[model samples]
Target: MNQKAPEVHPSSEWVQRIFDRISGRYDLLNDCLSLGIHRLWKRAAIRALGPVQGKHILDAATGTGDLAIRLAKVGAQVTGVDFSGNMLIRARSRAPASLGVQFVQADVLKLPFKDHHFDSTVVSFGVRNFEDPKRGIEELWRVTRPGGRLVILEFGGWMSFKGFTQWMARSARLLGADPEAYAHLIESSCSFPSGVGFVRRFLENLAEVKTQSSRKIFFGVAHLYVLNK
Candidate 1:
């Protein structure tokens, strides 16, 4: 395994402000940047858990409710939670009136749910943003029922991925996004825990655990992590 990278620091206030500023355009940028493969990546995460019908699923850090919506479409009652009010507002506006999905405002590290409350929990592209990914994972494990699943979709920084994202960041910076934000995007991956490391933590927090990892696009730039407890 790769040696743990030096811990990187990202202020909570800065992260919140950055997302707030980009809330309206977040979905657009995601689709444009990932070439719409993000949706498929999310679907892959959903599929890893087998079926979710009639199960209670929690989409933590569920900006814009994409994964939560997808889960609901599969007959799971989904609750989407995020700390950003503006992002939740956009998610609520686009959500169907009959999807049985509810959007809530809450921090991922300090979720307001009790143990064994959720049958499944999913966080899309949100884990890397956490100030403490381990604690966040533990929280997800805390709320999940025994034998349930936890899925995480986030960017990873392999050697090849580092090179490609470097160029993309330069392009994105030229397009008027705060250069520092793009810089943070590149650096955050290094700070993020890998699939194996995260799985180990989840197993420590929950019951039985399994993990799988898959890459996306050039240079293996993105990673989808599926873990069952």
Candidate 2:
């Protein structure tokens, strides 16, 4: 008999434990599984986020501080927040004192900062891990100053890439990727709405925000969203 896939509960505590367990190898798995293309995607997202020099920015669900490091390198004062202490420890080890990135242990749904505190906010491959994705987004909006932007990079199911996605998902383990983790990721991506569906939901929860969908990456295996408040 075929075995049922394990349920993926993206509660904050559950997600924290998952990252804590995978923290050591998380970066490697990301590099391998995406065939090292995530770097390009991340770079693209950062560029589209506009200038951040001398500004305050938040990198929520900042696993291992890759995005945080990039933001700091560009002269932004970056606060990278993650619930997993282990993940933050790895991030701290990799981050130099000169990098100017602050790694904090905090829940994304209830950010410790005051409202309208950040000049910009960004999350890559992180929002879907939220137990309440909408609430997670609302918190982002709460902290971003007026006229600031929110940028996100996430897995997407593009119509033309249906067959390609299937093939790629099958090829994941061939790259020595984490099979169980990728399984949950693929399931979550497919179930998460994108395009118009995503826009409508975002508009509902966030007031006075403008949104634009960017070109999908690798045939929509991932998507970029820019929301300006």
Candidate 3:
């Protein structure tokens, strides 16, 4: 018999603590885990945004401001929001004043923006961490302008080499990173819905949104989902 997937309802406080604890070495951890290919995945997500020049965009869960800074560099006015204060601190430091990227410390489930305020909204690898991913998506859609797109980049499915990934998580302590935090991340990705399942359960059932496209990257290691409001 097939096993049931684990539920992924991480509390807000727990999520905040995990991210804050890992913030200092968050970028390094990503580079180590994904072998730096995450940069390319992010680039693909940006490309899916299509013609962001002068557009007002919101980058939800803008860890270390990687996607936010890149969007700003390409002429989009970007506001990056995250609940972890430490993560936002690093994000602010990494973003140049010239790029004009604003980093805000806020919860994704309760965004501090006016309705229909952003031309487009994007979240990279952040949705799964939400205590309520469905409500988080609703908040993203609430801030997006009519006809604006909501782009989400996330781990598409389970990583192939479970043993190796577990080992990496264990070894994270050697690099002064929290192994439990990395383990939680790996666990969440394994449980969260991906690809068609994600769309059907999250996007398709939402009356106010339309699923524009869903693209799998790196043989379904990650997915880029585009939705229009």
Ten-residue segment with the worst summed lDDT in candidate 1?
1-10
Q: Which candidate tops TM-score?
A: 3
In model 1, state the lDDT of residue 118: 93
- Per residue, candidate 2 scores C-alpha lDDT tens digits across 66-124 of 98998899899999999999999999999999987899899999899999999999999
Number of colliding residue pairs in each model: 0, 0, 0
lDDT of 3 by residue, 141-216 (tens): 9999988999999997756358856766665766777756766777887777899999887787665775578989
lDDT for model 3, please: 0.87
Runs with alpha carbons beyond 4 Å of true place in candidate 3:
1-7, 160-164
For candidate 3, the TM-score is 0.93
| lDDT (C-alpha) at residue 16 in model 1 | 74
Ranking by lDDT: 3, 2, 1
* TM-scores for every predicted model: 0.84, 0.87, 0.93
Q: What is candidate 2's CA lDDT for residue 31?
A: 80
Clash pairs (backbone) in predicted model 3: none
Angstrom error at residue 226, model 1? 2.8
Question: In order, what lDDT does every prediction score?
Answer: 0.74, 0.81, 0.87
What TM-score does structure 1 among the candidates reach? 0.84
